[model samples]
Target chain A: MAETGTSAARSDAWGVWGGNPPRNRGRQPGELETDQLTIAGEQLPSRLILGTGGATSHAALEAAIRASGTGLVTVALRRLDPGAPSLLDVVERCGVRVLPNTAGCYTATEAVRLAHLAREAFDTAWVKLEVIGDEETLLPDAVELVTAAERLVEDGFTVLPYTTDDPIIAQRLADAGCAAVMPLGAPIGSGLGIRNPHNIALIRQKVTVPVILDAGIGTASDAALAMELGCDGVLLASAVTRAEHPARMAEAMRLAVDAGRLAHAAGRIPRRLYATASSPTGGLPW
Target chain B: MQLVVNAVTADVDDAATIADVVRDLAGIAEPRGVAVALNGAVVPKASWAETRPADGDTIDVLTAVQGG
Candidate 1:
């Protein structure tokens, strides 16, 4: 992975992602120590995963994806013209791995079938499992999500389930042998931006697998915040695709993710209700 | 026999398999990156040659599209 110099963003932050080593030995800094994120043993240099949806045009989508520096991009299955240029064409031109999602599925059967179809179509076993319970909020049905995950795992697919922020569902997904648990920060496309950080933190703390903040991200700050809260990655689409300037927003998201990872490793100071002195108390300037 | 493919009506042979229908619609000898579902259930590629769709069946042929 090429170094982005983002590790130097914070002076107090330890050397992270191949910048410099910490001065002290045996003292851990924070969660991330490297630039690579491993999911199902696939090492990726990028922590920001982009989805190929909601872009106004294929040109914008291609440009934004390339600018984001995302290693993994998602595509969905639908009834499309076989003659038209495919989304995979864009993903391939970008030179990134494809993560197929069962986006419109509402049951385990449909999701499982779609997973199988995706595997055959992409010749890949990595699936982003999404079993939405209803059409209103598009919240995942925890039970169906876990069931589809287990089925896919048994079928030799790397299942990455899109679940709720509830830690219990996260644990269920982990227990079902998922590659990772992607908890929504809020409803899809709501741009709510991590409504319950506490729950996300709890899921991160409990699950042994990587925790990815998947949805409800409105801007770069939301992605950075997810990383700061100890998430392994952020998967977003509309936050960048729907922006006024998609390529620029994509760049911002990339920098934000890197900065957030750096801040997490640098070890943030403890929060206090009272003011603390940054300058010496004995300073004569007073 | 008549069949509905992606909401379009088409005429097919009574003994035509799903593979034949796909070939007719997609204009490919052996289609790649496409999946077929008959009556809401996916028809595996291996079985496409033998799985015949009944008259007036809804055949949904789906492929990868840009999505979040």
Candidate 2:
């Protein structure tokens, strides 16, 4: 397939991988110029990845999706009527890419099976591999997650495994050929933002693959903090969908992600043991 | 013939295809955005008409739902 101008530019942003050179050929006028978030050789314009769950109404969900300006949105498969107002219809209407997730599966087999089903349903090879180990914590089972990631990678799916903040597991998933590794900030939907920022940073430092901070984001600050910690993206659901004003929160999260990305790129000042004056003392004293 | 669809037992014709089962369970002529699995394997859309559910076989019809 011939590469688009945008994708070619993205390939330039991230050097070519796996023997295929990054395509950098086209330039467009007046496009929103920003650093690219390349996942599986694809450039996603927005750093904020939105979730489709927990919206009180379809209107609210649609509004939030629009407000967020996210390039990717996550949806989970469940045993339900296919004729209903499926989330697929909504996301399709919005024109952003849909990422089907294996939300409730516990075993590698279950997650893999669901991923195939989602592939058939969504006609997309991308799967957010989530293997929940514990019911209470909703924590990812690292062992099963690696197994599933390996299997899906072999199956030619773009496997983005949802893993823990542990750097070892993060490395394992990347080694398993996952497109990206998503480490939870905290338990899913706990509103507990970035329980271990250091661990997330460690994972970022350890893996070459993109690190997406998934779950447990309470609000805009949490999303910002994730990006500031060098996360490629943020995957969250309840933080926006379950809020009293979801649309407003969606806009805030969008802005926060941009703000954090800019801040991280601009670089931060070093922590000081003593107070360092922002203004020059000699000039002020005179 | 009896079949368990989404864990609900339902009676259908002996040679019922996955498409038929989906339409029946959803109570709609056209079931949109639904994917089917017979037993433990997904039945692709192209094979839906050819694949028939046998007795004691489980059929799972899934669609996009609100989840994280």
Candidate 3:
């Protein structure tokens, strides 16, 4: 593992592929390697955070989570349902950390209350704060989100707010002492992919905390694009859960996140309008 | 005493504790992965067996569910 700085925006590129033991994995002589995704001083195994929503069954959800190689998975707190199959059982079996979210809340008080309940229910202080503004878009209410984030942080909770791609809101959340800021690419479950890559990049520049691209992902390419846009990680649910073969899609996303992270580190060639010959002018044969 | 449990009106014994309502009324066989909130404040697991909710008090029993 590479030595990490104490800064909040510490490099997320320290993790090896999938954060798994690289015993027999193929590697070149001098290839760059990384270790784990750290959030709030806790290390996560992978950069992809899977949301346990919209799955057809527990069996399928478990398979998808395993395939994705995600170290953290999001769950929501809801009214107890005795008849409903236990989601905790599957998550515990998978062995990933549960990140409870305030998904349906529209106000700061509601989200704060849910966070408290989640802390007791899950026995963890980590929360994925979400205060929605509009029901149609499921966008974060900027004011309410900041307020809830501040309150949660004050109460010793590690808050990660799901917010807009706007750099200003992202900065505000970070300033509120949140562990991380999750900016959406589009509306929740819309699968539209990153609507504004520029804003995501700007957010990366603005916030010191980790930037996670949450929601509005349709496929593996979208996940890859998020990493390329400088997001530390990606969070999505319907993209994999709603797919015909969730496990397969999960695998694709896992690979894409790895590939994209490496590509981002490797850096891409600058785009040029005019033609640039690969063959040297003097070495070209007549 | 009548207490609102998870939005449903439940008639419970006057001495019913939060744990009682959770186990008997909410039908949670095992309290693992379960949490209770009296009114709007969360009640810790250690206090559930001793804390009794008053009549008309809202008790929200929450647990982990598949969601984002």
Candidate 4:
């Protein structure tokens, strides 16, 4: 595949990895300088993927996108409202790849059709496939999702499916040729955080492809926890866009993703019921 | 001819093609980043000029918007 003009700059921005030469030297084992987030042969600079949704204005959204340092952002397809500000223009100006989504589709067929439309509109075969089962919960219809993912994959799309936390479903999506499986930490926009970290870890273990935690991130810590739980990346919208200060929150989320990834790479200490003294107990007088 | 564009019924010229609908009816002067769906199938940009909607056909003219 031909590299986009931004690829070189993006690789530089990422420091190392993703076909870029190693920049960090003399580093301790398990200490990473930077790990590029690669999905479907595309090496993304930042692990943080922003969704251009719920922002007060395009200016605010652009600021958040720039602050987040995301190399990829998601946009949804909708009926063209004449004279409305173009989200594509703003995203293009920010210099990030667009991952157009089938956000409001309810069935596999609908999602498939929408994905085709996105491919034409965006001029990219990458799609964030979302097939909602219910209106109230906005949870994915697993069966429909898998079906759509299969169809999209067969159609030559680099499919990234939004799925449930079930490890089996994650594996199914990966087996169906999805480039990545985006398991929701909780319901979309609930901001409840990762309700089931164990399941997320299980999904991570189940799939060899990239595992991105999508939805239900209330703050930076939630994104950190997702990374800590073994998610390859984090995809969020309302957590930052809906915050009191979108840019500040975006920056915080960016740092949190990096910190959590480093912590995960560094390997944390094991938990125990009994407390262990950090200082020398033998030398301390009672 | 009449067409159902984005669920809105509108009367258009008989020879109006998908390009005309996208430009004139949808009010999108620059159709670079826009896509059109005739009935239910996507009409590619190159074919949009030749693809005409019959009476009562549903034309969905779509563009990118802020969403997750």
Chain B TM-score per candidate, please: 0.93, 0.89, 0.90, 0.88
lDDT of 2 by residue, A1-286 (tens): 1111325654575443112222233433323245778999999978888988898777788778877878899989989864457676678777889899999999999999999999988889999999999899999999999999999999999998889999999999999899999999999989999999999999999999999999999999999999999998899999999987787678778878877877787799998899987787786555
Q: What CAPRI-style quality would you assign to candidate 3? A: medium
Tell me how candidate 3 scores on lDDT.
0.87
> Tens-digit lDDT track for model 4 on B1-68?
88999889999999998888888855655575788899989999999888878999999989999997
Over A1-286, each residue of candidate 4 has an lDDT whose tens digit, in order, gives 1112334565577542222233244456434434788898878989999998898889888888887889899999999888897787888798999999999999999999999999999899999999999999999999999999999999999999999999999999999999999999999989999999999999999899999999999999999999998889999999988988787678789888987887788799999999998887686566
List model 1 lDDT by residue over A163-246, tens digit each.
Answer: 999999899889989999999999999999999999999999999999999999999999999999999999999998998878
Worst 10 residues of 2 chain A by lDDT: A16-25
Q: Is candidate 1 or candidate 2 better by lDDT?
A: 1
TM-score for candidate 2, please give it.
0.88
Q: Which docking band does candidate 4 fall into?
A: medium
Candidate 3 lDDT over residue span A64-159, tens digit each: 898788989999999988888889899989999999999999999999999988999888999999999989989899999999999999999999
Error of 2 at A231 (Å): 0.9
Off by over 4 Å in 1: A1-34, B46-54
lDDT of 3 at A89: 91
CA shift of A144, model 1, Å:
1.8
lDDT of 2 by residue, B1-68 (tens): 99999999998999888989988788875566678899979999889888988998999988888777
Candidate 4: which stretches are off by over 4 Å? A1-33, A284-286, B26-29
- Name the candidate, 1 or 2, with the larger TM-score value: 2
Best-first order by DockQ: 3, 4, 2, 1
